[model samples]
Target chain A: METRNLTCINCPMGCQLTVVTDGGEVVSVTGNTCPRGEIYARKEVTHPTRIVTSTVSVSGGVIPVVSVKTASDIPKESIQAVMDAVSGVCVNAPVSIGDVLLENIAGTGAALVATKNVAAKQL
Target chain B: MNKAGLSYYDIVIIGGGPAGLAAAISAKESGADSILVLERDRELGGILNQCIHNGFGLHTFKEELTGPEYAARFISRFHELGIDCRLNTMVLDLKAEAPSGDEGSSNGCIKTITYSSRSEGLVQITAGAVILAMGCRERPRGALNTPGYRPAGIYTAGTAQRLVNIEGCMPGRRVVILGSGDIGLIMARRMTLEGAKVLAVAEVMPYSGGLKRNIVQCLDDYGIPLLLSHTVTEIKGKERVEAVVISEVDENRRPVPGTEKEYECDTLLLSVGLLPENELSRGAGVGISPVTSGPVVSESLETSVPGVFACGNVLHVHDLVDYVSEEAAAAGKRAAEYIKGGASAGSDTPCVPVKTGNGVRYTVPSYIHPDKAGERITLRFRVGDVYRDCAICVYLNDSRIARKKARILAPGEMQEVILSGDELRSFPDLTEIKVCIEAN
Candidate 1:
């Protein structure tokens, strides 16, 4: 039997959830006040994922960088690889928000989209 | 418009950030005749322009939006409503007047705002009501008083953010963050993505001052160490930061002896805390709260000076911009009511003071007048420390009125409770409403 303790991130409440499992079979969930906490705990224990957000260098734009984020949550383990891949990527000016910067990043099938609109510099 | 050769407005809001923008829009919608927003910044979004991170507008827009996107939504609405705004204008002083001894005058109260701008020399505008939304400023290294030589490598977390996001310049190649503020955590990830090495984040508090999600996503995911109960004791550098000495702190946050650790870094980022920009409030003779560093406000968000209101970070430091918008809207509505002659500063109605009990820091809207508080009142507060399996309780005149169970609570996050006017009437002689956290 194994026990896992986690903090729920669904809201500001930050519920402290404890999940007890025996050989990968769920035994009990405690400390959760709502069903969302229960579901968060189970998914957190297995197949955890998170949406990655970062900035990419921009050329000829009003600003030097544009913020981007994964279209959806990606595997937790691929966070670094996704960041590594994003580090080398740069976009041009006139990039609008929701514009895709990378497709299928780190084999996670999540595209990186621009989070801010960067207009071209008036040179 | 009254007074010879003086520009007059029904409402004058002192900001153009999300708070001010939302306030102007709400005031216009609430039927204010004339409104103006004066902003010191060149743009309308304030800090949101550089805060490019996602996870904003979850409560307001019902969808995930970036900081700029969220702010843009309000800014667009502000323009759509044809609200008057002045950019790059700085308010130097504010004064309240009581209609110049004309008791029978139509205007009962007035405010004079002295401001300056590059294009427009010195200007003064009088208004019937004013809403303060000047926001807050990050605590700088000078406030920390760390032993260090005057160096160029040290910068506030927000200043570094503006440099990286707005100017597209790197503050340093190697960085050491002094506090675990949210901006510091987010900057850790930002600097890493921008090809900078973040050595570590040292926090004097035992717990991180940032949100748990930020800790996991920014530090834990990035493999950056968060040294809790530790802080930078010294900065060792001549021209620029070359190294920093970190030491473990005791329960009182004093550095312990013989626990010093050194790190070689070119940059030291300070994110110790934020102070509400209340100098303007003080200049206007507004009563300030020693705890919040904001104005002492009533249930209607009216400051000590009648016809004057305050909200947002100028009122209290909020964890979320969504709440700032909500609070600013309330202030805007009240300011509009004051202009429409529907509100008064002095009321004979009994007012109950809201006090912070053990384990809590402070509450906004320090006083509540149940008679004029409308149908409901939302009280927002922060905890002093982390608590597990705690119950947040509200008492009116020593009788428990509201209690909610929480699995965990932390100082970094602001919590709120709602009390309806009907519920407040239960205690007719209510003198105080205490909000406290009790260990379960």
Candidate 2:
């Protein structure tokens, strides 16, 4: 049996949860004060995923870059691959919030979308 | 603009952020006739415009949203209400009008707000009630007083956040952050994602001032070390930051001798703390609380001035914008009641002074009027330091009124204790309510 300690990010309380697994199967979950913690711990131990938020280069905009995020959570192990994909992207202004820049990033099936609007610079 | 140019409104909000927007909505819903929101920025959202990170609106919207998305929800509602708003306008001064005994009202004082913008040189707006939501600002390098040369590469964490997230400009390649504030922790991950090398994050306190989730996702996820009980002693560079000398600080926060270590870096980011912007409040003669550096207010959020109210960061720094919105909404409702003459005219009854006891930093709504106490009243406060397994106790004139068991309490997080008006009314002639923490 192996034990993995995790902090449940469901709420600001940040409950410290312990998940005991035997042969890659979650056996017991403890230290959770809420039901969501159980769901989070089970998923976290088996198939961890995280939403990626970062900035991308922008050209001819009032600002030099635009902030972007994965439309949905991606696999935890694919975070670096998703970030690498995001680093290579350069979106031109005028970019609007929720505008999809990349589809199926790093094969995680999550689109990268802009979170803020970047207006074009006026002459 | 002359006094004749003064536009009369039932309520005038001093900001256009989440707090102000929520206040305006509440006021309008409370049967307020006219409302206006004056924003200094070019757009509706304030700092939320540049905060593109997610984790917002989990409480209000029941789903994670980016800062801009969270702000847009309120902005849309504000527009739907057709509330009058002026962009790029800065309020210069606020003065209360002398009481004119005209109607059956007890105290009648209209507020005169002086504001200026490029379009309108200077305009004085009159309102039956005013809500102060100017928010707070980040503590700068000057406040730190470290032995450092004035350098171009040094920036406050919030300024760097605006530059990178909004302006899309990289401040530097290599970075060292000071103070471990929430903004500083968020920026550490931001800089790393932008391909900038983040060497380390240092905090003078043994404990971190940021949330544990941020420490996990921002620093730990990126493999950056957080140096507790450490601080930057000096900055080395004439034009830009070249290196920073860090030293371990004793418990008393004094730097120890012969413990200096140098790290080569091009940027230094300070995320020390935030201070409530209360110049407008002070100029208006509002009572200031030394503990909060904000306005001392009543349960209805009324300042010393009868018609002036304060909420949001201008009242007290809040860890979550959700609470700011809620508090501002309450202030708005009360201001509307004041304007409509629905609230009680005078306070003949004695008011209770809420005091902070051991381990308590400060509480919002510093005073409480027993008669006006609503059904559910929340007393929000922060701790001076970290404590585990503590019981937060509330005393009404030496009698235990309420107690809440906290699994853990940290200065970075805000704690709240709720009391019902019926319970408070039960204790007549109560002079004070003390909120404190005791070990379990």
Candidate 3:
């Protein structure tokens, strides 16, 4: 059995969880207080993905640009490639909230969208 | 035409989070004839809803509970007390209605609060006191200036937490967490358990910023590597997150040369820090502490503005929800007193601002009025870094007012030292207060 120590971040308890795995599958899980910990552990041993948030350059804005984020989750390994595609891209000012930056970015099924609007920079 | 306008309440709290909810309950219990709570979210519970893990309510409830459970305990009590809570309602603005003392009151103080709701369309209410409890927001990726091609797989820990716990969505397959705060450590274990390989939890600090228990349980137990004094210096990806360059930092927190290591991963989670949500507080003209980024309160938890009180994470970031509830209870009790005209009499003697000294990061209850009889001052603050066998000394100029020995101290955790009203009486002519950590 492969014993793994896990940290429970679901709350501040930060409980150390011990997950015992057999044959590359979770055999028994211990040391988690909430179901989220067990879920976290099981997923850690399996699949994981992350939500991405970043900023895009906006021409003619007061703050130089505004912040943006992926409205949906994306593949874990594809984040670097996705961010690279977003790096060179610049949106014009007057972008509205929820405006799409990139639809189906890198074919990851996650759309990069604007979280806030930067009105065209005043001369 | 006798047009009946919206009725006014004794107190109106915005943001229905722990701070707002606790303030409402305290206002009612303190004899505020009417109180209202406006929450923008669909439900009353704030960020607590997404926090499904336990370790809450130990101090206030004397039992361990999850985030929802802790919030539920207060929410249920709020309902039991018949506090008016309007969910799915957003407060747009707070305006001073009139000058103090013009309306036959000793001080002319009135607030006009505008709000909107699906059921009520547009509505306005007036109140004598307003409490700002909007809480704080997480630091995002750009704030760190992490050199990288813009990437897809980076997320704030809170966002990922919400997606996983509330929406039942996976965030990534192979995860690497930045800044070993509690969230990142927890997520390291969380993603790992969900069948994701957490490459490492990298922190720039020499010592782990998260709780000691987290280091043991989250990273050590899971065999997830914790690279201390290291940081993700660069993000390498063309279209998505491919790999990251991790580098070690010296004591000054500057990256060292020739120690760069590369880790291939698809995702990065940032749990760097939390900043107090002070936009509404600033708009309301409340004095904010530069260090804590929350309101500067006296012993009674009353903000610089009279009748305005704050509590919970809105007041300052608390390490535990139990402490939040406890602090909120105090704010609530004080708000109730203020409404009942029972607040501590104003002091003619100028209040002295407390400063943090060696080994201390910051101190709360920024000012103390010695004349405020019956007030027990609880000073909450944090240390600079990890320490062993240290003593926390509260000093008035050169004279020490209070001192306590601590077995261990961590900057990630807040510490509290309570001074009873009787004890404060001894230092009546206080000019200054200082909290310092010294070797035990």
lDDT of 1 by residue, B185-296 (tens): 9899888877899999999998888887787668876789999999999999999999999999999999999999999999999988899998888998999999999999
TM-score of chain B in each prediction: 0.98, 0.97, 0.93
* Candidate with the greatest TM-score versus the true structure: 2
Off by over 4 Å in 3: A1-123, B1-6, B96-107, B344-350, B373-375
Pairs in clash, predicted candidate 1 = none
Ten consecutive residues with minimal summed lDDT in candidate 3 chain B? B100-109
**C-alpha RMSD of each candidate structure in angstroms:** 2.4, 2.3, 11.9
Q: How well is each residue in B284-356 modelled by candidate 3, as lDDT tens digits? A: 6778988779988887787876777788887888877667767877777777777777664265645767778
TM-score for all predictions?
0.93, 0.94, 0.76
By DockQ, the best candidate is: 2
How many clashing residue pairs appear in each of the predictions shown?
0, 1, 57
Better of 1 and 3 by lDDT: 1
Q: Per DockQ, what order, best first?
A: 2, 1, 3
The lDDT ranking, best first, is 1, 2, 3
DockQ of 2: 0.60
Give the alpha-carbon lDDT of every model: 0.88, 0.88, 0.76
iRMS for all predictions? Answer: 2.0, 1.7, 12.3
